[model samples]
Target: MDINDLRSAVTLVSLLLFAGIAAWAWRPRNQAAFEDAARLPFSDEQGGQS
Candidate 1:
């Protein structure tokens, strides 16, 4: 119930949150969506018209 304990709890929560998001992003069901997002910057280009 001290400041250090609170800090440790916050750190643990943050780590768990990050891991969950990483797992979600790498799941097979999301591959296509992620790939499409990864290509978004180049999506506007067509037939080398730039």
Candidate 2:
């Protein structure tokens, strides 16, 4: 019921919401796009020479 308690509750809620969204976003069909995007930076960093 204090400011500290309110802050902790907000942080916990935010983390849970983020986890839910992340799980939904990474569902099988969406996962391939996410994986491709995730690898893009690494590929670019390696000069994309492969």
Candidate 3:
């Protein structure tokens, strides 16, 4: 296996991984979970007593 072949394989694997993740993340069934994750930083877990 030449260096170029390894490079091409790595690129193809990376692209496939990116596409799979994008699909998983954007699918309708995952919308709620993603939305909840998106709100984690603003959740105010300390309560409203401030």
lDDT of 1 by residue, 1-50 (tens): 99999999999999999999999998999999989999999877765753
Model 1 residue 8 lDDT? 100
Query: What is each predicted model's overall lDDT from 0 to 1?
Result: 0.93, 0.88, 0.94
Q: Model 1 segments beyond 4 Å from truth?
A: 46-50
Backbone clashes, each candidate: 0, 0, 0
Ranked candidates (lDDT, high to low): 3, 1, 2
Q: lDDT (0-100) at residue 15 of candidate 1?
A: 100
> Of the candidates numbered 1 and 2, which has the greater TM-score value?
1
Model 1, global lDDT:
0.93
- What would the per-residue lDDT of candidate 2 be over residues 1-50, giving only the tens digit for each residue? 99999999999999999999989997898978888998876775656556
* Per-prediction TM-score to the true structure, in the order listed: 0.82, 0.57, 0.80
RMSD of 1: 2.5
TM-score of decoy 2: 0.57
Candidate that scores best on lDDT: 3
TM-score attained by model 3: 0.80
